[model samples]
Target: MKTARRYLASEIYRTTIAVILVLLGLFIFFDMIDALDNLNEKFTFVSLLYVQALQIPNRLYDLLPICVLIGTVIALAGLAQRNELVILRVSGISSKRLLWMLWLITIPFMIFAAFVSEVVTPYTEKKTSEFTISALGKNSTKMDSGYWFREPVDDAHYRVINIRRLNSSTEIDTITIFEYNTQDNQLSSVTNAAKGILQHGELRLDNVTTRTLTSNLAQVLTNEQAPLESISSLKTQKTISFKTSLTSERLVATELQPDKMSTPDLLNYVQYLEENNLQANRHIVALWRKGSYPFTLLVMITLAAPIGFVQSRKGGVGAKIFLGILIGIIFFMANQLALNVGMLNNLPPWLTALLPNIIALILAFGALYLMERRSKPRNFIHAK
Candidate 1:
């Protein structure tokens, strides 16, 4: 049993590594082709290649589950074609025992996936984004617009800030802030700055213009009454400093994305958003998904196990491989669909993330059970 397990592990690992390399090569080639249109005098072909190299970790992390499935199917089907699996089965190795061995062999892969998702991918993704933005000489934009943040001033007031462009974590341009009275939800003031600097938990606004509305003006605006004369006072300052919770690290977290964030960073960001009463559904979903990623590898292997149980006379290895690829695509699509549906309906984060995997596990186990039942009579006859 030990020898068989070792042999199975080695075969799966070898095939998985080969599959991952081929997939990565294909992905990088396509990415290089797509990056051609972005090349310029400053951003040359070499720079483009470097950027793609930085992105390889993230791509590998994304492709690991699919590669595992395909690799396992190919390895197991090849073994079955050579009658190795039949020999092992006839030697008192139950189908359930074989399934358990497959799951056991997947532990190393699960650990690798977890490490890549939690450590390597986040750092590489951030560097890729920063490098691309710097090379292109532009500000980073999120969701086709500027980065928006909400910060609480006190019980009675809160501020909404918009930055049109971010050159770096510490530098921003076209800053806009709107302060509102929490009691009446009335606009109290507006501040606009040409540029801003963040340092040591302090935000310094340069060339600032602030408009403050008087109580009467606020009432008038709330009542839809037009004021003929100037009702709000405007003030200009060369530079103004304020202590803020929006540190450079948090700014970078906001600028990149929730999915690109490490688990700890994503957790902190989600808490910050919830505390400020900001929308954090997407981040919450991403956090749950990240937490469940390791189990996703196990699920992929389970889905591939039954495909290898088919006899060589019934189906060729090519057909089994095609089936494996089809199942992998379906699993990917189902996961994405569940995420969107869960977000749209405001479902629980854990449920949204694990739904597809749970469903796949059930289907996989059922298929395994059927295969075991079908093989039992043959085993009994051989023993007699």
Candidate 2:
């Protein structure tokens, strides 16, 4: 049993590596072609290639399920075509045994996927985005100057409405706030800060400029094109009390997007949201999806076992491979749809994450069940 397992594992590993190289090469070629349009004097082909290279781990993580589906199927189908499966089955190797063997073989792949998703992909993706932005130079949006939102007050309502970016640790890169007068529903002030930080629900602004506009003042400003007053004062303290309702939750929801967050980051974000009584449905779903992604290798490989039952005399290996590809595509689509549904409907994250794998396993077992049942009367043990 150990020898057989080793042989099958070795074959699957070789096939999977070959498929990954082919798929990775094809994908990077297209990425290179796409990156060409963005190339310039500063963002040369070499820099663009560097950016594309940074994306390799993310691409590999994305391509894992597809490669596993194709590779495992090809390996098993080859065995079937060569009569190895027939001999094994005759020696009392049931579909259940093959299923276990496939799962065992897929364990290392699952570990690799987890590593990519948890560590490598996140860093590389962030680097790719930052590099692209920096490489593009001053063309990027550098915090809106005209940004504002209602700041609720008994007299002057204020709300820290928008954050442009989390430029670095120990500081908020940029922000916009709106202050309103409750008496007449009039705009009192528009404030933009070059940099700020949130500490205990208050936004402390640095290098802020406030513009208080009225009809006459607006006309004066429009006509004069006078230098805008940079609001610098001791009384203002350059501090805006952020609504207690706002938290890091909003930052995570917007700038720190779920797709861009690693598993640990997502986990921490989810806990923060729960503690703050914020709705974390999307983040929760994303976390589970990341957690379950590694196991997709097992599901994809198990799915290939059903195709291995097909003898060369009945169906060409190409058809079996096509079948594997079809199933892989369907499972991938189903997984995506399930994630969306979970987020939209507030369904259990774990259930949504595990649904595709569970369905694939059930179907694989069902197909093998039928195949075995049909072959029972023929007594092919000796015949094959």
Candidate 3:
């Protein structure tokens, strides 16, 4: 049993590495082709290549589970084709034992996935985004409307901040802030700044203009009364300091997509959003999905295990690989669909994330059970 386990582990690891390399190369090639359209005097082909290289971790993180599935299927199907699987079974390794061995072998992969997702992917993704943005000379392309944040001032007041572009970690441009009165649910003020510097928990706005709506003006606006001089009073300042709870770290965190954030950062951001009474459903879903990734990979391996039991007479290795790919695609689509539908309908974050994995596990276990049932009759006949 030890020897069998070692052999299976070796085969799966070797095949998985090969698959990773092949898929990574293919993806890089596609990236190169796509990068062509973005080429310019400043953003040359080499710079684009460097950006693509930086994105490799994210690509690998996304592809790991599917690669594992395909590799497992190929390894097992090849063994079955050569009758090695039959020999192992005849040597008294039951199907259940083999399944357990596969799961055991998958532990290292789960660890690797966690490492990549938590450590490697986030750093590399941020670097890639920063590099691409710098190379392209684009300011606010990370988000179309800009990076928005909501900070509560008090029970009856809050501020909505919109930064058109982040020049750097400490610098911002085209800043717009909307201050609202929660008691009346009315906009109380709008602050616009040409640029800003963030330091020491204070944002210093240069060339600032603030429009404050008086109570009468607010009432007039709410009543749809049109009067030119009834407009809110506008105050301009050369420089103004605004204190905020958003530090540079929190600012950067808000700028990144939830998937590009580490789990801890994501959790913190989710809490921040909830505390500010902002919409965090999407981030919540992403948080749950990232947490459930290991289980998803386990399900992928389980799904692959049954494919290896097929004889060469029934289907070739190519067919089995194709089936593996199909399964992977289906799983990806189902997971995405669940995410979208769940977020749209406001489903629980954990349920939204784990629904597809649960369904896949059921299907995988059903396949395993059927395979075990078929093997039992054959084993009984052989014993008789």
Candidate 4:
């Protein structure tokens, strides 16, 4: 009996994974083609293909939760059609036990999704960004005035850096620095440079200007420009590149924004965000979404069970699954809406991120309970 149960579960799981993969493949193909059309302005055929290929992991990350739902639904529904779940019930598996068993099957996939979110998505995004820039004949991730960031030490001194652009390959340009006295609440010094370059834990500034303020009352001012300075003495590697510096990895120790960060980077960024008093709401919600994503897959599976169990009238499991897709669509819309609202309203990112799952989970579980409960045991277990 145990062996039978195991076999039944394995078969369903395999089929579900297969269906999800096929769907994901189709989605990627279409999406890449659409993206290529947009990149036509900046990329050649080969570069466009390379950039899009590097972006597959990101696409897969976005589609994983829905794939989980669809795949689980189809496989479980097939089992229900074969009366395998009935056999499990007759063998003394309670509905809750079955649900738990389904959840157990879901755990690994959830973990995989999380892994992709943390390790795969961010790497691909960074690579994608790099490839895009290279194809466009530019270097650096630095945006206009490049990257701007502030750091504080002892509330008496802090540094600010302005970058013009970050090249595709970790190059920085148009660097400016300001060191201010927090106690005096005045700008202590200003450094302007033609460019800033970072390499191997060292920063080099070209065409530099240094300004010094001599009094608390702001009476004395001195300014000097040095064409070059190596700022390796600051004890902080991040002050050179904000993208690498303010990355989610440096903000936290764990893979906080799995969907948005590679694991190693996510951990650091999370730590940095907390230290800087920056709002991590959006990132936090993404973390929770990764955790809850698997349950959504199980919900999709549960939805499929009843559809496949019931014989096809005019609209069959296909229609039901279509409905399931609609549900997924609605769920995504709601989730995105909540995220935007949360950001705008300063609401908790975690709550907004989980809203879709919470709503779906409730509906899925309630429907399953009522449907199973309302039906007679024999009818529930066996076909008409």
- Highest-scoring model, TM-score: 1
Residue pairs in collision within model 3 = none
Better of 2 and 3 by TM-score: 3
lDDT of 2 by residue, 347-368 (tens): 8878978888889889987888
Q: Tell me the number of clashing residue pairs for each predicted model.
A: 0, 8, 0, 38
- If scored against the real structure, what TM-score would every candidate get? 0.95, 0.76, 0.93, 0.75
Q: Write the per-residue lDDT of candidate 4 for residues 74-116, one digit (tens) a residue.
A: 6655666566666777778766666666666677777787677
Best by lDDT: 1
lDDT of 4 at 356: 68
lDDT per residue (tens digit) for residues 185-270 in model 3:
78989999999999998999999999998655556757765675646788999999968877766766755667667998888888
**TM-score: model 1 vs. ground truth:** 0.95
Q: Where in model 2 is the C-alpha error above 4 Å?
A: 137-161, 165-174, 178-190, 195-206, 210-260, 274-278, 380-384
| Residue 88, candidate 4: C-alpha displacement in angstroms | 5.7
> Model-by-model lDDT, in order?
0.88, 0.72, 0.86, 0.61
User: On a 0 to 1 TM-score scale, where does candidate 3 land against the true structure?
Assistant: 0.93
lDDT of 4: 0.61
lDDT of 2 at 260: 52
